[model samples]
Target: MSSSHDTHAAHDAATSHGAHAEKKSMRLMLHVWRQRDPSAEGKFVTYKLDDVSPDMSFLEMLDVLNERLIAGGDEAIAFDHDCREGICGACSLTINGQPHGFESETTTCQIHMRRFEDGQTIYIEPFRANAFPVVKDLVVDRGAFDRIIAAGGFITARAGSAPDANALPVPQVAADAAMDAAACIGCGACVAACKNASAMLFVSAKVSHLALLPQGQAERNSRVLAMVEQMDKEGFGNCTNESECEAACPKGISVSNIARLNREYLRALASSD
Candidate 1:
């Protein structure tokens, strides 16, 4: 082939690849729920966003959508987020019928646009649970979790002289178990995804972490009783062994912790006067 013809063909191929890349980065329709207040009715509002980068995090994509809305003289979507690092558990959403979509062991804040295809229709809903009523678009009142914790989930150690780290030598097995339970981030995903909307998994993790530790031994019995009582008071349902909480938990906390919580409650009751 002539050198001029070869160069022309290469240019054509590069142009075609650029066009394909642009097509691949095209827009999508995001149907997000909007509510003015807890008592107000919510409706799905559709917004179209074009040329969204696949590398954008889910929250960043929403930011782009909000910017467009403001530019178009429309109200922006409201959502909760903090520590976008997926640690605060504030970013909660029910995306496409999954707590955090098809991604295993991830929070809503950690989801990115790469999981979705161009021109896909995405449905975003607030995490739903009786205890977590909608406060606004994609925002729910998760104060129920806080109340449960306040009842007696944590130890009551008074601050004083710093104790030696090795003063209480915990067994390796017990320490490891405690650490596993302590991994819970207090995200209400478990409650949102459960058929019964039970908070047993969250409560169990707290109960198990404290029950297994020596420093927590003093109030172990009372802690379990008080927390479980507060859980019921918060309008959370009883666990029927459906195990939905474990499947939906972002932390993958086991259902066995619920079993442990039940056992601890029973033991506490039996030993009580």
Candidate 2:
């Protein structure tokens, strides 16, 4: 409705505002773990960042650090990230001793630099667990999770192609529970948070999600048994009921799934005997 002159002026104003916003920055200190590889001795190396943007996500801040290191002819810090929007669960840094930092119900990639204070020293480390050994700084081998899932996290039923939602006839409660357990992203924050580095939370979610559904009934008992057995064989420790796993989970996956896993394992054991 306006003249072309007014439109050009508005565009100029918006561009100026965006340029101004980008100028805002923060200073921070980072004590990041540095290890050449699994066999190398790891240590925390301090780096001072003078121009961090509050608008940057946590991973973006790391990207900036890597750029600076590359410019200085130094090896960049190694880390994991995929689908920076948080669905893939690949950003696995233990920031300030908290998995995914201070953010609640959010992944590390979803955490903004604004959550930190200016001039604060942040400690970053890879998720620590026997099953999740560090491959490099802030990157651990999560293949143990893949192995557990492969053990029996699925149904062997011959039910071909996906069925229509209405044909399933699943109860609302059961469907809701299944969907809730299915939300797990397999981030291993549970193992990192547990004192014993236990993977019960992760294993349980996989078990409960399928077991609660009718399609999972045929292999439910064996599924739990196989997954739990693999979880132990991977050198992961036992859950002592400390519940730190639930607290660190970005999805807030309930520990009640762990209890269901215990029951399923018991049932499987009794029947086998």
Cα-based TM-score, every candidate: 0.88, 0.90
Model 1 scores what on Cα lDDT?
0.83
Summarize candidate 1's per-residue lDDT along 148-228 as a digit string, tens digits.
Answer: 888885567654787788987889999999998998999888888888889999999999998898889988888889999
lDDT (Cα) of model 2: 0.88
Error of 2 at 152 (Å): 1.1
Query: What's the lDDT for all of these models?
Result: 0.83, 0.88
Which segments of model 2 are wrong by more than 4 Å?
Answer: 1-23
lDDT winner among the candidates? 2
The residue pairs found clashing in candidate 1 are none
In model 1, the runs with Cα more than 4 Å from the true position are 1-23, 158-162
